[model samples]
Target: MSAFSRFTPLVSVLPSTVPFVGPEAIERQRGLKVEARIGANENGFGPAPSVLAAMREQAGDIWKYNDPENFDLREALAAHLGVTAANIAIGGGIDELLGQIVRMVIEPKMPVVTSLGGYPTFNFHVAGFGGRLVTVPYVNDREDLSGLLDAVKRESAPLVYFANPDNPMGSWWDADRIVAFARALPETCLLVLDEAYSETGPAGSLPPIEALIGLPNVVRTRTFSKAYGLAGARVGYAISTPGTALAFDKIRNHFGMNRLATAAALAALKDQAYLAEVVGNIHAARERIASIARANQLSPLPSATNFVAIDAGRDGTHARSIVDGLMQHGVFIRMPGVAPLNRCVRVSVGPERDMARFEEALPEVLRLLD
Candidate 1:
């Protein structure tokens, strides 16, 4: 039973770990069914009816491989965002594209800058590619732009990752500040501006496409997972200069996109009315989540994403207890992976029924903790 030993040094040294332990895995491990699935910032409101209809109509086309160029989706996204199709690169999701970006820029032991305790998946990708991660701590619950830029300069790091409407804490930076940060980075460094929560974010929170489009070093990633409720579809895209965007084609899995997912995205893009409607619901659900957190005596942070991170008024262990305690009652939620941030449990905005379940379960869980 000896193992074959020809794996690359990087692969050999990496630990076997998943970035996120999904709710399904939790269910299997703990033997409990999730009644309110709001842990991962998924849109429990679900995809628009038009998107669903488009997918169903194209389901019969499953036998065909998706266009490697992703022509139609790119065209649709370009028109939607007021950019040329050449400005876009499609991927299964932001996660996959992060890997591709890391591969394109990182070499063994090269420094990559990111916010400490920010979007673990990007960190995961950096580690997978053998890059040295230079982290800057959050300042006042937002990613420290100045610190990240300093780290990039100090380390001569070729790449950096920053998520606006960031995960775990659900905090954001205004567009002006983000553009300033991008403009300030050294031309030698590339910035991965993750905007997965763009649709849910407030106006003026996202920089207009033209603001940074001229910069070859900045890539903004957006997703259908949060606001469009297409997590299962794994459709996301990156926006950058045509030259920078074309780098994805060099290492990307051609024909890797799902045909139906492309159809879904095309439909989703065309259904702006439905998107606006879902965004309204997302706003309402954010308030609902905050209200519930306040009712339970926890302070909820202001959020522009589909989730809120509530300060549990204790240490990581106490916040963890709330997370575990909720799961025991069939309410699944998540918490930040590191301290200071981990003092809060993150809750995603779900439909009213899921919200009701969480509302009923939270007090019981807190009472148990007390």
Candidate 2:
């Protein structure tokens, strides 16, 4: 295939790929339908009725661009988090915010630190910007704070990402430990403390807004996509010192936000009761997933987030077979990409119907594999 001749050296050298394959793409490529959409860590309980109503109410205003500054959302988030408006930066989602963060601090070949099998999207952004990745392996299925710190110091890395209630494994460290790790870091090394699963994590898993808010080197990212059930809305925010928060305004696409999505997020925030209810449902579904895994002789790891990672009690190849087998039954699921962590298959919490699909399919898949 022919392509444009005038491209940057980096762009020409980089392979064209996304971090993860979407289920739609899987369906298209494999001629299979995803009946149980429990692969992506999406809140299958869905947004509240009030959120839908708000989006419908805003439908007439879709023709107009969203407020470029995102003033209202930031103010609302600030009030909710007990911070000033200047301390918040709103973006399409945490993914976009991660890219912007990498672009801001990482020059060509600059070292960035993260867990070995951490969030791949962040690694995708780092690679896109020509940043070198310095990885620290997981300790006992959780991100290694000490290992990450050591790598950062040894490499003199400029940026480090640590996701609480982490993805893939759903493990987490306590708030105090996380805060201590943040304080121990060199002020020159910025920390992207990703709390995307904050709403769904255990009580003590997330540090208070006041704990790291004063640190210019710390940027904590959160999203309405999990317990709030607004993954499609693409609403996420970053909390930091006023000076650090303002940097996002320099590079972020000001009008990229969808008007209805913003309306959905605003309404989701207002409905605290609905958020609590959905979180309960998530917890219950997590238990149900664990039960299903255990009944089939698989071990389900304890999760602080909305998904459970079931150890297939074998190597990565065995876990891959389980993931592929489940998909054959119209159940879509995912697993970690590297060794040891990849020994488990990840299943997201969903409504009862989706859960039933997973339950009915898992045992049969395991039986066939046996």
Candidate 3:
């Protein structure tokens, strides 16, 4: 009737939680089918035909263990990014890679810097490793670069997590500013530049890969989950100096790469034309979301990511009402977990029908809330 008593002290004290409450869990809890799945930032447009075909081809290989080194995928990613394979480290996705990064760098009580209300999963990893989280609040709905720098310097932190085309709020900074922020950090602190939304960001938003690839302290994490429409594939990679990347080999799950998922990613990378088409669709959906928000008299923040965060013209409580109200109508959406940011509802881009469902639900939700 009781749990094992021999677990580590850190594990014993950690609260059991998932950083994001997914739509499936909501469906189970509320007994409502999600008719419009515009939450969790998933690309509802789905993956390319080439990607699905590649996965189907690899289906028979499920009986075999994936290549432990993930060589072909690494090589493919390296070639795609114009970096050598040595500079890349593949993991299930950015989420897994984040845990590996925290494990590699954070020790008990070590300080980890991040923007407050930034990526909560990274903070969850930091907590699991017993690292102290040093947070800087967002300034004007964007990550505070200068404040984050100050926190790192003040705490002499070993790691900092920043996202470009950031989540929840979907704001981004120009590449020059990010490069400058990365360069300004002390060599002792490692920067986790999360670029999960990189493919969807506007021009001038992402730095050239070369800008920080040479920095041993800089590791850029990206995923196939966003614009590539491969969230379920769980394929992601980290780019850093060859020396910096080898650290992952020390603690990562060597055979964690799924064979079919790797096949999907490889095919996705090869089909650049499909990626371009998806990005265009994402742009159009963002505009549609903005228009819907405007119609409801809510202010939509300019987004460079696949989602739009609309200011609901009230506080977190009101925003929660909107989120809950939409779910009641079988339309799922999300909002930020922290103050100020929570005043906005975050909606992911999807296909026309999904957008139409959201467009129809917004006014009704707002009307009920009003």
Candidate 4:
């Protein structure tokens, strides 16, 4: 195939491949359907009825572009979060915002720090911006905050990514410890404290808004995709000092937000009752997944997120086989990508129907493996 040859050296050097192989792609490649659909860490309980109604009502307004400044959504998010409007930077999702942050600070070959098996999307963004990744391995299935800080200092890294109630492992440190870790880092390093699973975490697991509110170096990325059930809507934001928040405006897509998605987000925020209801459902589903893991004679790692990581009593190969076998029964799920952590498969909480599919299929998968 012939192609244009005017691309930058960095762009030409990089592989034009996506990091995630979504279930849709899996189904196409393997000729299998994803019946359970409990993968991707998405809230399978679905969005609120009120949100659906709002989207339906606003469907006619799709002809208009969303406010370039995102005025209404910003005001509502600020009001809900008890922060000034100037402190927030809205984006398509945490993923896009991660790219913007990387673009802001990372020049070619600059070092960025994160857990070895942390969120791959952030690392993808870092690589896109020509940043060198310096990873600290997980300590007992959790991102090591102290180790991350050490790497930042030792490498004089300018950017670090930390996910609360982290992905893949679904582990978290308490608010105080997280705050201490943030404070210990040098002011030169900016911490992207990702709280994509904050709503699913236990009380006190997340730091208060006031804890790191004043730190210019700390930008916390949050998503409505978790407990809010709005992953398809692609609503996410970051909170930081006004100056730091304004940095996003320089490079972010000014009119990229979808019209109906904004209406859905506004409606979702107005319905705290519904959010509380979904959060309860999430907790129950988490317990159900853990119970299923236990009944299969596997160890279910405690998690503050909407997913549970089960120890398969073996290695990554065993974990991978269990994951593949589950998919044979239309149970789509995922596991970590590295050793030690990859010894476990991750399952997201979903409605009873999905849970039932997993519960029925898990034993058969394990029995086959055994």
TM-score of each: 0.99, 0.99, 0.99, 0.99
Candidate 4 lDDT over 259-348, as tens digits, reads 898888889999999999999999999999999999999999999888999998899999999999999999999999888899999999
The residue-level lDDT of candidate 1 at 88 comes to: 99
lDDT of every predicted structure (CA atoms): 0.94, 0.94, 0.95, 0.93
Model 4 TM-score, all chains together = 0.99
In terms of lDDT, which candidate is stronger, 1 or 3? Answer: 3
lDDT by residue (tens digit), candidate 1, 1-370: 5766998989989988899999999999999999999999999999999999988889999999999999999999999889999999999999999999999999999999998889999999999999999988888788999999899999999999999989978999999999999999999999999999998888899998999999999999999888999999999999999999999999999979999999998999899999999999999999999999999999999999999999999999999999999999899999998888889999999999999999999999999889
lDDT, candidate 2, 89-113, per-residue tens: 9988899999999999999899999
Candidate 2 Cα errors over 4 Å, as ranges? none
lDDT-sorted candidate list, best first: 3, 2, 1, 4
lDDT of prediction 4: 0.93
Worst 10 residues of 1 by lDDT: 1-10
lDDT digits (tens) for residues 20-66 of candidate 3: 99899999999999999998899999999998988888899899999
How much is 266 displaced in model 1, in angstroms?
A: 0.5
